[model samples]
Every structure is written in structure tokens, then in C-alpha cells.
Target chain A: MTQNRTLSLSGERFTAVYHIVCKPAEAEARARDICVEQTIEFPEALVTDASIRDQIVGQVLSLQAVGEARFEARIGYPVEAAGRELTQLINVLFGNISIKPGVRLVGFELPESLARQYRGPRFGQAGLRALVDVHDRPLLCTAIKPMGLSPVALADLAYRLALGGIHLIKDDHGLSDQTFCRYEERVRRCAEAVERANRETGQRCLYLPNVTAPAGEIASRARLAKDAGAGGLLFCPGLAGFDAMRALADDDALALPILSHPAFQGTFCVHPDAGLSHGVLFGQLNRLAGADATIFPSWGGRFSFTQAECRDLVAGATRPMGELRTIFPVPGGGMRLDRVAELSDFYGRDCILLIGGDLHAHGPDLIESCRRFVAQAG
Target chain B: MTQNRTLSLSGERFTAVYHIVCKPAEAEARARDICVEQTIEFPEALVTDASIRDQIVGQVLSLQAVGEARFEARIGYPVEAAGRELTQLINVLFGNISIKPGVRLVGFELPESLARQYRGPRFGQAGLRALVDVHDRPLLCTAIKPMGLSPVALADLAYRLALGGIHLIKDDHGLSDQTFCRYEERVRRCAEAVERANRETGQRCLYLPNVTAPAGEIASRARLAKDAGAGGLLFCPGLAGFDAMRALADDDALALPILSHPAFQGTFCVHPDAGLSHGVLFGQLNRLAGADATIFPSWGGRFSFTQAECRDLVAGATRPMGELRTIFPVPGGGMRLDRVAELSDFYGRDCILLIGGDLHAHGPDLIESCRRFVAQAG
Candidate 1:
């Protein structure tokens, strides 16, 4: 309902702040005009205080003029508790109007509601540390990937890896419902095999399936895997939108810990200053987004991430913010089994050690092979 | 099956040219093992041939090592017809894998097959010149947003904005699936309104609507709108994935021009020489991704892009690479109407200028109000 105050008056954001740049000083009024047209669809007189406008959107922060023809304006919104989190939020902030030439948004100041709902990591530093019983040692992990494998084929590998004492065994990000491996079928078979193996060998290996699709299908999929005896869900918040993680966290019944994957999340970590700081974005935001453990490319991996950047990522994932404990940083891609100690020393016990291909290299007799690797490392 | 030769025995990506960083030497073997594991899951003997891998995945120039733990990969695939259309190949290269992580592709090198498909503006450079017949003068555009509007309400505003000769009118990205204006109903009504306005004023103002959604639904929605007489479709490839845009371009039946939005895409643009250079990402890559026009946060908008970054975007959108002309750069976010002339001069007339809130502030009579604002600027 604040739409009236927002539209007609100079004090409201519909008129207050914008990085308006033009030769004529009339740009402010023009900018104000734009605010009404974009936010309310009508002038002050047409809208009312109780209208949805007051609730759906609000002013974030505004700057007068920083550059040439540009102004920075941040609009605020209550955090979405349901579907399509990041996508919906981004659209609300700047969507169709983004195509207009000569306008830019240089910064954003998130409201506490949105910030709180982001949920960062479902299990922070202490939580993940408690899960694997590894304190002050890099957490060990790996992926069963290259897709195209049958459920039994992948399960055999998972069972072996679990027996080897690897802390986590994630399905490859590509393991969607391709003819090679149906999602539910694969998760079911693999979970059973791991359970059986763990019973015999007394090793704890968690299986995290990559669950990403449209908003509606996500929670159901998570529930399906959990019901099928799976340990956790690997959530691609970037692909599914960050808020999806929070929704999972919000569910008391479906309280499976989440392992956040960087799939399609390059935009957040790719840019330095323009998007979010490493600590704020991956650390604070991912935790807010409800990630229990978050994965990223590490230094000395197949991907070219510098030590400082990797370190920053580690710090972000493990930093304490408010009541949230912080997330575990899992670094993978081209990691070798032998260097576990080095990576562990670098990231301390608050990290998830991800070794993808190295685990696969121990082929044929999966149990014996993985047992040696795990014994040598973790 | 070159999987073995290319991924295993070859080691270090030596047979191919992508030099992703490797430390302790053994990491290269692990990465190769991953390629071997992911591609030819059954045996190490397969997946060795680059050609076989191409058959399944597509062709590519090379995957390189960008900064530490980051990679700069260049993949080149045919444009379905061409001789190095920079635009088409980028689509075929990583369109499938971008959804997965452990991929930090920071750079690209396009070939001719891809170069030809990057058709900028569709009505770009010269074609748009003939439409409004404004030679060397900048064009003005505006947005219709805030959702919750009835189809009738939306159409009325579209009618007025179109009659004002604003050149373009786009829906703000948030106008999707809410109770207010559903996709088909709103598109049909808005298109009719724009057409009616054209009949009255003899002016053609284009309406671009955001059509980003789940996988199968995307193509259906695009075709639906095109059938309903839509001029172009708006998509944030960042949200829907690049494949969605490629799907639109490849559809000969639904050959509507596409305007790419930068909603969740700002994260990628915020980096400096990190994820992807803006020229390569928004311009060349978007062109490759099949966007007729690419929208970025203009330097002076509510976003953080500096002036040099904005101008670079213009060059990225318009500059030529082989036969494919550059895409049109539609800079936007918190833009005002009064600065049209300045923006026009900076970006040239081939662009679509966008303004939002300013037009509504004109007066009570929406149509007359729209006319006065457009008149004042020109």
C-alpha cells in the first residue's frame, strides 16, 4: 500500500534514489517517472496503500549519479520461501527492463529478510565436522561420474568407495534422467549397495544426488531419494535458483543435509567486484541459501583457480556470520589421492576434500582399490 | 573412441591443446581419468578419439587453462551449415555441459561454422534503419512492468506507449505466471494493442516479453507467442540456460528475434578477466547463443559497470567477427527517458533504447502522456 507514498511523493524510492545521469537536471523527475511506470503500472492516484506493490517490492538503496548515463537503484523484496528463488529475485530486481540501452545496476544491498532466508549452509563448519567425525582435517569426498552408467554399475562403485571410508560420494552433476541412468532408479540402487557395504565394512560414505529441475519438481525429487534410503541431496541452487536450498532447509520433515554444487553458478564466483565478494557470496550467501557443504574448483586443480582465490573461497565457505555456523568448502577437479594431506592442511578440517577422477583410477576390484586409497589418506 | 588416446594415455591434455593447470604432475593423470571415466564409462579403451567424443558431444578448438584452478576452453561446432559462424559454434560447444560444474570455462575461440550464425539485430545495423527511417538518430524505448496487471490493463498501456513512437516496449521480467497476467493471455492482448496503436499512429513499436522457463516448456512457449503475432522473445539465458536460446534460433518456424536479459547474468559480468570477458560473454557468446540483441547493465544504471565497460559492450554487440555481425547491445536498468539523445549518440541508432517509470509520470491520460514524453525527448 506504500505505492501511493512511493509514487506521488519525493521521499519514497519511486522518486528518491537513482543513479540518473543526463545534461538536463529534469532527469530526476524523469527517473521518478520511470520508477512509477516500472513498479506500480500507474501513477500515485491509481494505486493504494494496501496494494500488493507494497509487499512484492520495495526500494533497496539508491545512488544519485556515479557514471555517465547510469544510476544505481536497488529494489527490495521479502525473501521467497517457495519456488524459483534466485531467478524470481533477479527478475524482480531487474528483468525485462534490463534490455533498455544506457541503464546499469552497479550494486545491491540485501534486506535482512532476504539475507536471513538465504540460509547460507544447512550445516556449517561445526555441522559437517560433526557428520564425518573429522575435526581439523580436510573432509574427504569424490564423485561417481562420466554418467551413462547403469545403476548397478554405479552402485558397485559407490559401495566400494563407501567401504573405502570416503566421507562423501556424489553423483556426477550430469547424472540426470538420461537413458543411461534414470535418477530415482540409480539413487535407489546405489543407496542400497552403499548401505550393504557399510554394514559389512563399518565405513560411512554419504551419497548425494544432483537434484535440479524446475521449481515444482525439486522438493519431490529430494523426498523421493530420501525415502529410497539416500543420505543427502546435492543441490544446484544456481541451476535451481538459490532460494530452493532454503526451501529444503525450511522443511522439517525433509531435513536432509544439502551439498551445494557450483553447477551454473559461475556468474557469482566468476566476477570479482561486480557481483559479490567471495566471502559474502559463496560464504555468506551460500550459507544463507541453505547449503550444508559447498563445492568449488580448488587451486592446483584441472580448472585454473589461483591460490588466493581458492583461499578466499575456503574462507567464505567457513566464515561465521550471525547465528549461521558457515559451510564446508569442498574443492575438487583434478585432485589426487596422495595430496589429501596438503589440501587438508590448507583448508583445515572445515573443508570437504573432493577427489573425482582419482577414485575412478582405482578400477576393477573397487573394494580393495578404494580401501587402500582411503587408508592411505583419510 | 578416442577417449583413451585423448584422455588416458595422452595425459596432460597434451594430445589436445587445452592446458588446464596441473600440480604435482599426477593431477593431470587424474583429470585424464575423469575424461576417460565420464566419456567412455565402460572401458578406458574407448573415448580416446577426439572424433568419437565429437560425435557424442560436438567439436571444439581447445580447452585452455586460464588463471589457477580456472580454465579457458574453446569449443567449435558447426552452425548446422556454415563456414565459421562464431555465433553457432559457441552454442554447440558447451551448451550441454554449462549446466554441470567442475567446468570453469573463462575464455573462448570461435571458428567459422559458429561465426556465421551470430546474426545481430536480425533487423540490426541497417535493417532497423529502414523501419522507423531514423537515420543516424537514436531510438527511444520503454518498459511495462510491476506485474499484477490485468491483460486489459496491460493492453491499454501498451497501446499508448506504442502510439507515442517510443520504438520498443518490453515487459519487465517479473510478468510471468502470477495471478495477474498469464503468458498467452497477456501476449495476445499486448500484441493486439501494439497492432492497434500502429494502425492509429502509423508507427511500429516492438514488444519483447520474457519467455524463460523449464526445458520442454521453453520451445512450446516461444512458438506459441510467435503464432500469436509476437515480434520477438525475451530470455535470460542465464536463467533458462543457453540451450533455450539456441532452440529458439534453430527453430525456422519460430524465427522471432531474441532479446537476452541480464537478470542472473550480472554475476558473470562483475568479474575482471575471470569467468569470461564481457565482449566474449554478452556479445560474442550471446551472439553464438542466438541472441539477436544482448542487454547488459549500462555503466550509469543502478548496476556497477563503469563507463568503459558500457562502451565495450557496444563494441562487443556490434563489432564483426567473420560473416556474423555483432549483436545489438541494449543497455538498461534504472534508465530515464530524458537521456535518450546522449545514450543514442553513444551507442548509435542500431540499438533499442529502454525507459520504464518516467513515461507514466507524464500525465493522467496515458496515451497523451506517452506522446508528450516521446515528443519532448526527440
Candidate 2:
């Protein structure tokens, strides 16, 4: 079982922090196993290449007891293992280890070389503000919904919402290219309606169509949205891969801001002790994958996310990460018009205030309701 | 908030079974909430259109007590809601509800029209058996491993494994286009090496290269593998979106048998009362999304999958689903040669027996170990 060659150890390494839930005696062993499992995926004893053992296998930089029967271990892996791609970086981060229980990836620190390789967030917080011509207050955003609505009805709603000064109006993540409202017709009518409203009101309201489609059609669908005058794009990185979102962001031809929606991604963060933390998935990862704004369930909503978790999520979105621009943390999910002031005070102007169904509560004249929402949000 | 129009509902519908964990008093409310949350996403009180309520919004078909504080709820949604795409089907199935706790998607039943829409496995069990010309026994598969290995070293291993009578030799999922072994070079050399071995041995051994690259590079890389004479393709539907795998499976140009690797997909199945059941994620979903063979961590392995869970996974893979062909249930992850008989009895001949690191144990003489694995497996 002897190898003929010794591969060079790539010097640059990235660190990942994991919270391992185990007994005091099992902590060290579990940490060591994670190091081996994430990297080589082979028996360490038989790895005859000493350099492979020393350099390639994950190095446990530090480990400490965080809570009863839980230990936080910081492990470093060579940047080469990531293959200098976001997809592979994620694979190296949590691939096979995700199947195992009690190993939650809390946070990570990538080397400068790897961080620079990804083109994150084309139109981040400042860029989004520039697009909407609003810098003083939180950007007011809404989703056009009730799945069975015809394209014309959806367009009418978009027109009114745009006239009322909503900065970013996006399609509901559930509104794919369904038969009731096909993607092309819906995007075209909404974009035109929003544009007509923008012309009348002198507001730079952006219509973000949900371009999340099948893999083959995603890029073409995005191009169609852009050609149809879509102001931005709403993508579900959880449903379509994170790399798909990154690819969308990095495409210079389709240079529209991207708003990431949390659809199938909830499994990664819902579990406290097994999957990722809320901040890591919705905040850091979303920004790194090139989302201009990332949407998640806000606290006090119908969803179960707590206030502390929401705060952590906000921090992760706005935190400094090399040269990557800070993305807007758009919090929605059962948000209300009455809570607009309280949310504004807590989230500050860097956030996008997303109120969906509640906008209808102030309706009859939906435009007037949106205007009231804007005034209250400010 | 009244709509101007009522859209028609296509009669064909799909039923999704969810395991809802809540207090006895809250079970009905939670089940109803899921139906609304998964479909229209708007507040039900505001959904004034009665036909929209009756047709488009998910309808709870039945609810039954499953366990303590756990109830099984079968909810049906119009097939039109799925948008005739695998990606949208998943979005409609788990999308927003993934964020909510206590909702586990355990099973689903799609209408014949919807099932017929997807191009499932191009090379199913029978097709795969024909390709290898082996029908009487369980197929033997091994992964070339140790992340730092060069293309030459990997090809050498492939040559030996092929000579020793293994049916399939796939690149370790970790062996993406790393600088140590770029995908093009690795695929070319390994394909040539395996072909040379087949010439001498007169046994059909498929060298499946790991074609899981970043979104932009995946199709090109898959084409390169096929052009270079690789026998099959290995993909991580979880890493690259499941629809990406489906796209590859459906593509007329680069049509190769795809082996689905469970890398980043573990989160969907790990939680006991949340996420998806092992059968749904690994078996049914994989087949629906066009995976010819689905690899999972077997019970008694380094991973935490139990024997019961593995059996459920096998059932999910081979169960009758409209016109969709049955796929191979590959159980790997630290599987050993000694357990071949037990696994063979349990999984039956329709499965692919994947033994990774253990193949090196009877080694020094690697080919001999593979031969012994084949003999024991048969």
C-alpha cells in the first residue's frame, strides 16, 4: 500500500467552525473524525503519503466546550480542496458530513485567494439604493401573490404598488411558470405596468420577476425578463443551486440585482444542532453567492424564527467580508404594516422592509395603502 | 382585494403526505396552515375567490394520528401548480414549508400526466444491466479515492479495478476539478485505462467520472467526459441542483447513465420530525429527477442511517411509479467486503454494491481485493 508520488501541500487554507454535540470523552474523537471525513474520506492509517496526512487532511486548529455535551471545533482545510469554486467549496464544507448528526457548521473564514475567486453581489445595498433612488429610509418591497391570479391582474397589482412608491416589487417565490400565469406573459405585463407607473409617479420602482425555472431555461428566462424590462431578479438559491444564483450574478450581460428567496433552504437552518445557523445560510452564504438582497422569515412572523436569530441573520448580511459588497437583509413572512416602525427601528436603513399580505389589509385603494406603508416605514 | 378573474384549474392533482408534529389541539390548524402556506402564500381570509380557494390552494385530503404529537396529513395540489418542471414541483412540494418546523414530507403521489412529464432514468436497472451485460447478480462499484491523488494515479487505480472485474469505478465525489487532477485529464486517462483493461479481461467495466463542477462548467465538463470515452457520469444532484441532474439526464446530446451522489443532500433526510424521509429524498425524488442510480450511506457504516431507514430507501427506489423505470439503490460509505452476503440478501440483486475504503484493506494487491469483492458480491 505504498504510493509512488508525494503531492505538494498547497499553503492557503480556509477555516470552518463546527459545533459537535457529544459527551466529554467523545468530543476529541468526534472532532478528529470530522477532520478525516471531510477531507480524505479514507482510512488515515493507510494513507502512506505523509504529506497528504499532514497537509490535505483537515487540521483541527482549536476545540473548546461551548455547552453541556457540546464542543466547538475550528478546522482548517487547504484551499485547493475547494477547487476555487463556490459549488466545490460548499461540497468541501459540508458534503458527506451533512448526512451525519450533531455536526452543525456555525461559521467559516475563507482565505483571501478563495474569497476573491467568487464574484459576489453585483448590486449590493448601496447599488440597490442607487437603483431605487432611495437612500434615507428602508427600501419598501412586496410580493405579488395569490397563485391563481391571471397575468393581467398581477400586472394591475404591480402597477398600483409601483405608483405607491414601493422600491422593489418581486414575484412570490411560489409563482413559477405555472399555467395560470406563465413566466413570460406575467413578467412582460408586470414590467410594463411598473414602468408605466414609474413614468407617472417619477419613482424608480423595480419589478423583480421570479426567474427561478428549470436549469436549461433559467438563463434564457432571466434574459427574457431583462429584455422585458425587469428591474431585478428574484431567485430561490435553495431550489435552484447556490452556484446557479452565483452564475446569474456574475453574468455581465444580465446585470440586474438578485433577491434570494429561502424556499427549500430551510432544512439547512431549522435544526439547531445538526445543520447551519440562520446567519450563515441566509446572510453570509447568500451574499457570497452574489445576491443583492437576501430574504428570510422575520421574527414575530407566522414563521418560528426568534428575534435573536433574526438579529444574527442581519449581522451576517452586513458584516465585512474582504471586498464583497454588503447585501440588503429583506425580512418578510407574515410582516405587518403596523409593525413597520418597530422593524425600521430594529433593522436600520440597510434593510428592505417586506410586507406581503398585510399590504392588502390597508387596501380598497391599494396604492394609498402602499403610500401609507412607505410613510410609516420611513 | 377582490380579483378581476378566476383562472381554470387543471383537474389532474398530486398528493403530498406530511408528518405533522404538534399538540392534538393544534394538529388540524397546522395541517390547514401548510396547505395555504405551500400554495397561494397569501392570507386565506383575503383569498375572496371561492374557486381559487377550492382548486389552486392545497386541499387536505385526510389526517391520521401517526405518533405521539405526530399526525400524517395528505394534502393535494393541482398538477398545474407544479408548472411541469422538476424544479417547480420541488418548490411546490417543500418550498416555503421547509422553513416551518414540525412539517416533515414523508411521501407523495403524482398524477400519471405529471409523472410522464419527467424523463426519469435513461439507463434504469434493466438498461444498466444491458450496458454492463451482467443481469444475474448485484453490480459491484468502487470509488477511486484519497483527494490529493494525481490523474495518473487515479487512472492506474481504475485500470486495476477494471481488470479485477468491478462493474463500475467512479471518481470520489471529492475529486471534482481540483488542480491536483483536473477533470478533463482525469476522465481521459481513466477512460483509456479502463478500456485497455476491458480489452484484456473481456469484462465490461464503466469508468464514471465525477462531473459535478460549478454551474457554468458542468455541461461542458460532462460533454468532455463523454467525448473522452468515459462510460458513465457521476453527479451530485444536491450540490448542483436536482434539476441540473434532470437537465443532464434529459439532454439528447450527452446522454449517459447518471449516478446520483448524496453529498449536500443529507440535511433533507437527517431530522427525525422535520425535512424529508430517506425514501423520498434518496429514492422516489431521485428517480423522478432522472437519477439512474442513487448512492446513500448504508446502515452500520460510518454514517448514521439505520437498517430500517435503508430498507425504506430501497423500497423508494424500486416501487412502481407510473411508467417510470426502477433505478439502482447504491448503499456505500465505509461498506466492507465481509458484509457482502448480508447486504446482498437485504438489498437483493437490483442494487449496486458500493464498497469504498474497504477495497484497499485486502490490498497491497488492490486488484485481487476487487476480484474478491466481485466474487463475494455475486
Q: Interface RMSD in Å per candidate, to 1 decimal?
A: 8.9, 1.3
Where in model 2 is the C-alpha error above 4 Å? A1-4
CA lDDT for candidate 2: 0.90
Tens-place lDDT per residue, model 2, A170-289, is 998889888788899999999999999999999999999998888888999999999999999999988889999999999999999999999998888888888888878998899889
Task: List per-prediction Cα lDDT, in the order shown.
Answer: 0.58, 0.90
Error of 1 at B137 (Å): 11
Judge candidate 2 at residue B198 and give its lDDT: 95
Docking outcome class, model 2: medium
Report the number of the highest-lDDT candidate: 2
Single out the weakest 10-residue window by summed lDDT for candidate 2 chain B. B1-10
Q: What is the overall TM-score of model 1 with all chains considered together?
A: 0.60
Q: Residue by residue across A1-49, what tens digits does model 1's lDDT show?
A: 1122222222222111223335446545545543443445444554434
